[model samples]
Target chain A: RMDQGEKKLSSVDRTPLHTEYVKSKLNLEGKDEVRKLKLFMKYIGVYGADARISGFSGYICELLIINMGDFHRTIEAFAAMRGKLVIGDPENTESFDSPAIVIDPTDKTRNAAAAISVENLSRMKLCSRLYLNGKMPEYVQSNGQRKDAKDRGTNLRVFRIKKPDIMDDILYPQVMRFKNAIWEIMERNDLRPVSWEVCVKDHIDVIIESENKAVPALKIHQGPPVDEPSSLDFYNKWINMKISRGPYILGDRIYVDLIRQQKSIGDVVREGLKKVNIGKNIDDQKEAMEIFDPYDTGKDSCALDLFLSKFIFRAHPPEKTSRNTRSS
Target chain B: RMDQGEKKLSSVDRTPLHTEYVKSKLNLEGKDEVRKLKLFMKYIGVYGADARISGFSGYICELLIINMGDFHRTIEAFAAMRGKLVIGDPENTESFDSPAIVIDPTDKTRNAAAAISVENLSRMKLCSRLYLNGKMPEYVQSNGQRKDAKDRGTNLRVFRIKKPDIMDDILYPQVMRFKNAIWEIMERNDLRPVSWEVCVKDHIDVIIESENKAVPALKIHQGPPVDEPSSLDFYNKWINMKISRGPYILGDRIYVDLIRQQKSIGDVVREGLKKVNIGKNIDDQKEAMEIFDPYDTGKDSCALDLFLSKFIFRAHPPEKTSRNTRSS
Candidate 1:
């Protein structure tokens, strides 16, 4: 009944038989991991989380637990393996592009681990290594420490967004696109942030941390090479540039350092956001959006929590305020 | 007293005496046409209409009239020149890269036309050719008959910016930067405009005309090629892509038809503006910024006027709307 394509066809036809046979074989060897493997897979991720997410499947999780024993050893094996993780020696290895590849224990010809995502794999590795060392990193939406980004000398910009009415599979790409849009905006304005991350729950929170709350007054500009036809247009544009200094020639390229009017990161983001496609769902509730910083914005604890747990560690950065080193 | 470098040193040491001699010589030839030349230069631009604009200076303009004989003929000569216009050749042409090069009439060694900008040359050729052919374009800001842009089935977005309290020398570049920033925004949003123009006046108006008012529901997305390590990420991201079709492979490239959440151009701009550095002066009066279509926006004839004289010429586009034959 759950028909979509060839994958669904196989699942409907052979999945039940494979499940019964694999379980009985595991029972004979007293190697079935109903309790342990299920818990491990859940902790790492919802096995093959979405139909579109080609991460770890329950069958792969079961096979891994049987073969590698417990959670600790199974994850350790995955981490230690370099490059493509080819499991069974099948005759034809035409190759695949999934993050991790594992052969089916019951069906020698199939790849059981074809759906695992690289992002999920990266998460699993980071979490496993930390957990094994007796420390657990905060997962998304999990409450953790609350450190103000400003106190750490980092420029923090929190955008309170309304999550789109979409599932994680679709929402993941949309949110990623939104992040790219913000990142591009930040870079374009020369308020290039050192780091950024997104968190989604009841609502979406975008956290951007830059070295400076405001960029330097001067904007270093580049134009066409000395020879091109448009290089003259560049010269014309800059010679009549509306700034404090320059339209000066810097070697073969035209370079200028003009004063920027909107130097603050908050101001830039506030204004620049009106220029790009920020996804439709967020666009609908765009008016309801809230932008926050540490100094004056009526403090929200959720934003603070996200900054503390996700962005920074309690270990203080050497300096309280990062210098705008990019002012060259 | 003013000291910058070589250009200044030359201007101070030798330029004044040359200016005096040229005026006297032109007078002897019954051609002390300073008044005539000044008006012509201002009309054609490059007569210091903009502080930073390095076009034909008054001295260069005078030299041109004396050599080419009056306004009409001077423009004709400029229009006929091939690649790099070589004026009366100096003894040794070491070759400088400024737009039009002319051997200084006063000091045979110096290139008098070095200050002449390409933008001016381009304007000169365009205006001169058009004039000779019995026409004159509404250069920069001139009152001309207005025509509607929408009847042709094109997308026009207007941004009315409050002019910054800066001189033209400084203002020209800033507005250009603003235009470029908006262009990047439009492209990123997939509302890639076919043509974009900026008009600077008491208020700066940016006009962007795209073939699309709204994009298709799907976005034909591309990512890293297969066999590369990052290709796995491309696969993982799209395989579970939400609310769309495909993570299909075209040769070695990964492709997806993502359902665009924000399909409308207006919505994207409204939302995207919040994420960038919209410059200082613009940010201050950003709330006052208005975006609208033809029938809706309260009659500000200036915007409509620019769209007409500057963009459309009442000439039919033979094939109305260009369908996205690019759907290949």
Candidate 2:
């Protein structure tokens, strides 16, 4: 039957097949955008699993994912809307010069799905496909084209170390010092290490060029804290130094607020705490706050929480609390 | 401060960390024992996944999980073991010329970890500390000579169709016939058409090379059913035969068992199925078995289940199911 209603193919064919081409009659241009994106993704990496977002804002159109072994390969498709070469024309293919960053995707410790965010997707662009031989797949032809087999491998070198010498000398040196400081602060608070060696050093090139001077961007830090060992490490460090005379466990309200403010990396520390662990914990030690109830020692609860609520948590005392105090 | 009580170093020293000294401490000779073995599955010029097993006898280890991404970048330590290398002396650090396969020391996927039985570790012999780039690390440098850059990239290659003449003359012609037979069967059942263009095709190499004449292999299938009026036109013709039905859907359990018995490549079929529109729907087909409560549909369900399970889930079958009940 030449079916138009639902148009679903009702039977399987009995012939030897080579490969299935997606059936499309929409004149090549008009097709389901997601399906087109998927087919393109499959061609680029041969499989797709974790692509998300309705659309993207920058040069990127979508982010696709594939899980191989031990690592998650993320292909950030650049703005297909712009310089995308018309499909089927090998001569017209846009050169994907931007680098693709492969991430751990999910911090196993965190309960989060192994997904990439739109903001991080914007930070990346699909450069070129990396081959196992450390060369780009498209550039290598059997015709003995390039003199050297330099571009044969497909592992995209995401972060190019711009000043390799400078980085080997000054930049990495600074990063090491900063990392040490952060670790020291976390240690005092009895928190676990927040950094993985992979995340800390993958792309020295992109990070060095950006104004966001931190090692990993704040977006990496802005996710849920419960499963984030690194964030918890940082959080514990802040609590020990800033809030005096209490153990530093954050309450549910504070925890929820921190989650809501995930888009802002700075807010986690600024709004969520009373004292900052900017300087050395020992030499710069100064009393951050006086104990709220003199009779109560800080041991009963988290000292950091006590301090954050008093000095950082409240701008104006809750009106209900004030009224209760007045009645008392 | 050689404190003999476990002699812990409380502070890190400023002494330059020598690669030579670090190399000595690594005990490279015994470390290969720590890496594990896995299978590399490739299709459509890309890698699918790695499966680690106990000699294909099908005694699946408990911790087998999928390595999520970057198929080529995986550590090959636990691959088939190589003869022990002469370590400690860099000049004499010779090893048997072998494939680069290893058990990952840190596998994030629970599957790989579980499949790794300690018994398998018994087969491993240690080797030198090669860098992730595949070069011998600095610690193993002989006479201060660094490992070559070309030696650093991991070695794995996806095979390309080197001779199209072989496909044209011998392979694709046979494949086309089998696909037709399968499609006819599927059409008789009102099953959807699997793509002849992309659906799985049996490999000529495996078919000709194996000593046994009945060994079954996998090939690619076209993607799923379409909804547009134009798409249905082509889809109906594609699934017009019984052989095409093999790619579209698996018939009950007995059929799958029969396939498994002949050492048929079920994983290859699943991989092909993943591309079709109905591929994702394969999971739902199990529920359809609920209709045959009194019917001898056990055979049918077994085939469907066998087809549905990927490598990770295939090892252990439920006790109620008989191997004979399933069809391939």
Q: DockQ, per-model, please?
A: 0.02, 0.00
**Candidate 1: where are CA atoms >4 Å away?**
A1-328, B1-18, B28-56, B69-73, B86-98, B102-120, B126-146, B263-267, B270-288, B301-303, B311-328
Candidate 1: tens digits of C-alpha lDDT, residues A1-328: 1125535435657688768866765663335354565565555443554433445666776677676766668767654544455566645234545666666655655667766665455545433444555554343232232223443444677777787778776676666676777777788876656555566656676777664466544455666544454654664565443543333333334454455564577567667777776776566654566778745665543434434433101111112212221121
Which ten-residue region of model 2 chain A has the weakest summed lDDT? A251-260
TM-score of chain A by itself in each prediction = 0.68, 0.17
lDDT of 2: 0.23
Model 1 TM-score, 2 decimals: 0.42
Measured against the true structure, the TM-scores of the candidates, in listed sequence, are 0.42, 0.15
Tens digit per residue, CA lDDT, model 1, B155-197: 7778766888876666767676666766777788767565555
Candidate 2 lDDT by residue in tens digits, A1-328: 1236644321133111101221221223322443444443333321212231212211122212222111122232232212221221232222222212222112111111123332222212221212221322331111121111111110111111212233232344443343344344333322222221111222221110011112221111122222233333443443223221111112110111011111222222222222444323221221231112211222221211111122101112111122122211
What's the CA RMSD of model 2 in angstroms? 32.0
